[model samples]
Each structure stands twice: as structure tokens, then as C-alpha cells.
Target: MANVLIIGAGGVGQVVAHKCAQVPEVFEKITLASRTKSKCDKIAEMLPRKIDTAQVDADHVGEMVALIEKVKPDMVINVALPYQDLHIMDACLETGVHYLDTANYEPPEEAKFEYKWQWAYHEKFEKAGLMALLGSGFDPGVTSVFTAYAKKHHFDRIKTLDILDCNAGDHGLPFATNFNPEINIREITANGRYWENGEWVTTKPMEEKRVFDFPEGIGEKDIYLLYHEELESLSKHLPEIERARFWMTFSPNYLKHLEVLQNVGMTSIEPIEFQGQEIAPIQFLKALLPDPASLGPLTKGKTCIGNIIRGSKDGQEKIYYVYNICDHQECYKEVQSQAISYTTGVPAMIGAKMMLEGKWMKPGVWNMEQMDPDPFMADLNQYGLPWQETWLDKPFR
Candidate 1:
């Protein structure tokens, strides 16, 4: 058994706390923290067993260090905002604890996503003999591990990869994001990018669209090309891959509302003078949107996210697709959260388990694909998010 301190009490944080509590044999002691102690308290109440709760602004490194010193956890599971990742890492280093995060670090001032910021900490973590697992969420987490599993067991080499994320659930809102509104808006409105022929290619937001006939009755949906952080690391770690890209489905209703929001400058990240106060339009908009956690009970339907790879198994061209389907209401029934948070949070817990169990432990910061995939993949089915795999007749275009 190991002690764990989880940061952030948002929707994903709730799932992480619940999932961690469920595995008492692995996570013996649990403490949940966030900016608001009440949020942490609310989540702790939903858990099956008792757990400690605290409050700390993850943006402040000193505050995080103090909290880690107080809790003295064996590892810190970061489900906080992307901007606070580095600060949490700094605190974990000072407290001599291991680290794991769902999303990578994104500068608060810029609408960009890159792994360089966290990748720079490899030397520090290596010297300290502490392991830091980055991008342990669904896309960068499971999808990357899926690739490694394929490479290990199926493929002689992987040439091309396509990651598809589809959320067919509707929360009965005219406009809302599944997670944080500010982060969600910034990501969709940004330019799209993918890797091809060992080079980076860029496109206008939602420029490339495809209709995929999903399995298990999820049916066909419009998926658009987007520059997810996983594309960068997957290409780098799996250098044999010639092309790699990430795609996510969006409803027409969502696209129209987003367009209107963009035309009116409501999605802009830059702060402007408002009634003698400087406030980012997107931040203010986040205040007006529905909190993603509240949508759990209202949402219906399921989410499908997976990877399709085309490569050579024995000098003959072949294709393989592997993915998981999660239901919103089912997740809420189990963890009081929707599928988005459940999917991301489950992987975060499993990653922590792998580190604490010495299954994927090592010094230095590493992405999901850099580790062994079999054990993590096995845990997914044993946990809440079970995956399906099959041979594809055609390649994704």
C-alpha cells in the first residue's frame, strides 16, 4: 500500500479520487486538494471510504511545496490545470515524491501545447531518482500505450497512425464544453497541426474533416483534425511512424455556437479593460458556462476514443484499430462524473499504480509510450475503461 496526494478537485479530480479510493490495496491513504477545500470535500464525500481534504492554489510552487511537505505522500497525482503542471513538478521534486499528470504543461499566457517545457525536467528528475509520468490521460495516455502495444506484439514497424476521439453525449445545453470552458475553447479555436514525412504540417482550425463509421452503435460522426500533444511525442518516440495525427468529433450545434462566440471575440485569451478591471474574455465566458461536473447527471449516450494504425506485420500492408467506449450516465452512477472525466481520471490512477507498484517506475520524466504497455493496457479492462480491438479492412483517410 502507498499514500497518495491528489491535486485539483474538478470533474477529473473527482474521478481520480474515487478511482484511487476504490483500489485501497494499492492506495492506502488518500488526500485530495484543490483551490477550494469545499470542492475537495464534496468529492471526498462521494468516495466509498474516508479521505482527507485540503486547499491549495496549484499555481504557487511554494504553496504546493508546503502542502506536499504536510501530506508527505508517496506520489502526487496532478489532475489540475495544464498551466500548473510545472509548479506541481517543482513541489514533487522538493518533497522527494513521484509525479504523474493527465495533461502536459501549457503556458497560461499562450494558446500553445508542447512537451518541451516538461521534457526539460528530465535531468532534474533523473538526478533525484524520481519518476514523472507525463500525459497519462486518454489521448496522450492510452492512445500512446496502444501504439506501444501494437508495436510490441503486432507490428514489425508502425508507419502511420490516426487517433480518433468522439463524444456522442449531449448534456442538453445550447453551448458547453465537456471539461474546463476556457481550456476547451482555447484548444478548438487554435490552429490544427499533424506530422507527415518527418515534418510538421499546419492547417486552419477544423480544416480537415472526415466521417468515421464507429463500432458498437456509436455510428458515424464528423471528426476534425487537431494538434493534440500526443502527436508530437508519438512521432518522436515511435520514429518509424511516417505520419501521425489526432482527430476529435464535434456536433454541428457546437461548431455553430463556437463560430458565433469567435466572431464576437468571446473566446479570445487576451485580457481587456472591463469596468476598471482587466479580465480575459474567455475566463469571463468560463464563468457563464455550465460547470462540467454538473452535466454528469444530464448527459446521455457514450464516448468512443481509439487509435488506427497502418503498418507492416510481415512485409504485407495491414491495419489495426483499438478503442474504448464509455457511457456518461454509467460513469455518473459509479463516480458522479461524466465519461470525459472518467476516461481521463482512470488512466491517471492506473499510471500512479504502475509507478507505485514498480511496474513502470524509473528516474526521469517520460511520456506514456516510453513505458511498457501490456500491464497498463491490462489494467484498463480491469478498471472502468475497457477497450476493443480489431483488424481494419481499410486505412483512415
Candidate 2:
């Protein structure tokens, strides 16, 4: 049993709190803190076990360090914004506590996602005799683990990888992001990029489109190729990968609204002079949109995310697909969150469990794939996000 401190009180944080509470043998105590104390209190009230709540600005290293020192948690689970990753990591280092996050660091000014920033702290963590786990969320989390499992058991050489993420869930709102709005809009408006022949190929945002026949009767939907952070890490770690790409399905209505927002400059991240003050257009736009957490009750349908791997096994060509299907309504019933939060948060709790149990713990920064996938895979079945694997005659595309 361990005492864990969770930063960030968004939708993902709520799920993590609930899931952590469910496993008392692992997490004997939990502290859910955020910038807003009320949000933390709200989540604490919903959990079956007693969880402490506090207020801390995740972006401030000193604040986080003070909280860590006060709580004396064995580990810190950071579900805060991508920009705050380094700050929390620094706090963990100062306090000699293990660290884990679902997403990598992205600068507030620039819309970029990569593990380089976090990877640079390898020496710091190793010297401190602490561990930092990056990209433990669904795509970067379970998807990365899935590939590692494939390498261990299925493939001799992985040649191509297509990470298909489809969120067919409907929130019954015209324009609402499933996650954080600022992060969502910044990522969508950025360039589309993929790795091929040991080089990156860039295209216009959402330039590549295709129709994919998803598993478990989700049917065919249009998917757009975009630059996802996982591709960078996978390409680096799995050097044998010849080509890699990421695709996501977007609703027509969402696309239409995004197009209009882009045309009118509502999606711009650059600060503009407004009422004698500087404000980012996208941040202002986020204020107008529905809170992603509130959409859990209204969201319906499912999300299917997986990887289509084409490679050689036993000196013979082969293809395989591993995926997880999550229902939005079902997730809400269990955790009062949609599949988006549930998918990301469940793995986060599991990742912390892996560290606390000494299964994947080490004195350095690491990605999900760098660790063993078998134990993590087993826990997925034991937890909510159960996965399935099937052999494909050929690639889905």
C-alpha cells in the first residue's frame, strides 16, 4: 500500500481518483489537488474511499514541491496540462518521489508534443534514484505497450504501423472537445506529419484522409492523418519501423465548426491585444465551449483505438491488430466520466500501480514501451480497458 498524490482536477483526474480508490491494497491513501480546491472536493465526495483534497497550481515548481513535501506521497500522478509536465517532474526530483504523466510536455506558446524535453531529465531522475514514466495515457500509453507486446511475442521485424484513433461518441453538443480545448485545437490545427524511410513527411493539417473498417461493428468512418506524439517515440525506440502514421476520425459537424473557427482566427494561439490586455484567441474560444467533463452525461456511443501492425514473424509476412473499445455511457456509469477520460485515467492508475509494485520501476525516466508489456497487459484485463488481438490477412488500409 502507498500514498499517492494526483495533480490536476479535470475529467481525467476524477477517473484516476475513482479508480485509485477502488484498489485499496495498492493505494492506501490518495490526495487529489488542483488549482481549484472545489473541483478536488467534488471528486473526493464521489469516491467510495476517503481521499484528501488540496489546492496547488501545477505550473509552479515551488508550489508543487511544497505540496509534495507536505503530503509526503510515495509517488505523484500528474494529469495536468502538458505545459506543466516539467514543473511537476522537477518537484518529484526535488522530493525524491516517483513521477508519471499521460502526455509529454508541450510549450504553452508553441503547439508541439515530443518526449525530448522529458527525456532530457534521465540523468536527474537516475541520480535521484527516482523514476519518471512519460506518455502513460491511451495512445502513448496502452498503444505503446501494445507495440512492445507485439515485438516480444509476434514480430521479428515491425515494418509499418498505423495508430488509428476513432472517437465515435456523440456529446449531443454542436462544438465540444472531448479533452482540454486549448490542447485539442492546437494539435488539430498543427501540420500533419508521418515517418517514412527514416524521414518525416509533412503535409497540411488533416491533409491525408481514408475510410477504415473498425472492429466490433463500429463500421466505416473517415479518418484524417495527423502528427501524433506517439509516432515520434515509437519511431525512435523501434528503429526497425519503416513507416509510421497516426489517424483519427472526426465528425463532419466538428470539422465544419473547426474550419469556420480557423477561417475567422478563433483558433489562433498568438496573443492579441484585447481591452487593454493580452489574451489568446484559442483560450478565449475555450471559455465559450462546453466543459469536456460536463459532456460525460450527454455523450453516447463508443471509442475504438488500436494499432495495425504489418511485419514479419518467423521469417514470414504477417499483420496484426490490437485494440480496445470503450463505451461513453458505460464509462460515465462507472466513473462519471466519458470514455476519453476513462481510457486515459485508467492507464495512469495502472502505470502508478506498476511503479509501486516494482514491476516497471527503475531509477530513470522511461516511456511505456521501454518496460515489460505482459504484466501491464494482464492488468488491463483486470481493470476496465480490456483489449483484444486478431491476426489480419493484410493491412486495413
- For every model shown, what is its TM-score relative to the native structure? 0.99, 0.99
User: What TM-score does prediction 2 earn?
Assistant: 0.99
* Angstrom error at residue 309, model 2: 0.2
**Whole-model Cα lDDT of every candidate shown, in order:** 0.95, 0.94
Root-mean-square deviation of Cα positions for candidate 1 versus the true structure, in angstroms: 0.6
Q: Please provide, for model 1 over 1-397, each residue's C-alpha lDDT reduced to its tens digit, 9 standing for 90 to 100.
A: 9999999999999999999999999999999999999999988888899999999999999999999999999999999999999999999999899999999999988999999999999999999999999999898899999999999999998999999999999999899899999889999999999999989999999999999998899999999999999999998999999999999999999999999999999999999998999999999999999999999999999999999999998898889999999999999999989999999999999999999999999999999999999999999999989999999888998
Model 2 has an lDDT value of 0.94
Q: Model 2, range 144-218, lDDT digits (tens) per residue?
A: 999999999999999999999999998878899999999999999999999999999999998899999887889
Clashes of each: 0, 0
Clashing residue pairs for model 1: none
**In angstroms, how far off is 131's CA in candidate 2?**
0.3
